[model samples]
Target: MAEQDTVRVGAFTVGMAEAEGWVRRYFDESRNREVAATGGRTRPYAYPVYDRFAAGGAESELSDGDLLAPSLLNASLGIRAVYNLQTLRPRLEKGLAAIPPTLTLTDAAARGTLASLLTDLFGVLDGPDPAVGLGLTTLSKILHRKRPLMIPLYDRRVKRCYCGDSGDHPVEPVSRSAPDGPFYAAVAAGIARDLAEQPVQWRYLASVAPADVSLLRVFDVVAWERGGTRDA
Candidate 1:
């Protein structure tokens, strides 16, 4: 049979078969062995934040310490503490307030809402020095913790591996010049479509909550793994 044709989802174009292959590769033994070796050191600090929000806590409940700690330790992005939390906290609260309590990724309005929220959040720490602002990787991590299914962690590895030439570089913090909402939305929608069409691949993420394991995370894992191999 001829190779499957490509389909566009947001900013990503992926073949159905190719998407399945990527999903399968994530669950391959060698990959699991490597992930297992790391032993998920960040989960201890991260999962509580997810649980808090999921249990109906307000978005304002998420703190700077809660947001920055995991990213500094687990994201491997070399993020530094430069911004005053007092200055940054209110901006985060406003951005989080803009996000709806429930997000439906399939809806255009919902996607728009998310995109705007990200843009507002990214703009919070815009500064004279690029390195001084909240990094894109850290922003994604904070949003992902708040809504794992809707947001994917965008780091140097994932962007380089999945976003081709259009993706942002790891060194750049998200700003007006490098807004990331649309690209992330596209990738998330593409992954959601793949999972909807092929339920079997969903089984590969059996270890996590069914709600938490969306295409965004799958793509993150695949890209992170590929990027790691290339670095090695």
Candidate 2:
């Protein structure tokens, strides 16, 4: 969003080195330990429905006359959110049946071939909104549903890191609230960039580390980049 916004340079506590070592460590370890869940059956995502997340499933193909169409909303989350082979196959099958059996993939392998396929087809996968679904809740149970793993999930981290205990981290203007971030994205990028440019600890920057995979370390980056106090 604000790529060139005047970065509150000296205010950041965690420097480039800290982010590099921390983030990489956290990501690597999480990836190593946590087996990615198999789509819809996964924990918190289903929590959305339990929380009454009403976003419709992508249209069913073997249903009533006239396909419901492979919605952009369904496509968006299906493509990005469902990363496991077990779940991806079903989504791909549904996508193909409703849209074009040839739309995503016809045959999927169980050992994560679907995730691999989607990764390759990302270019085609990138398209209009399949749907727009948002249910905002900071209720402790809703917010702390799952421990954060590698790759920051954005919002909650933003609230915890930038906003502090209050829950409004690096409060980006409401208008800039997409995943790309007018605020959060910029801050994360800034910190990552600085970490990338660091001269010392070249290997740490080059490779993902074990510690930086979870929020335990992610908060440091979010806090530092979101304009949190350096002294903290």
Best by TM-score: 1
In order, candidate lDDTs are: 0.49, 0.31
Best by lDDT: 1
Worst 10 residues of 2 by lDDT: 64-73
| Alpha-carbon runs more than 4 Å astray in model 2 | 1-130, 134-153, 158-185, 197-202, 205-232
Report lDDT (Cα) of residue 59, candidate 2.
32
Q: Which TM-score value belongs to model 1?
A: 0.55
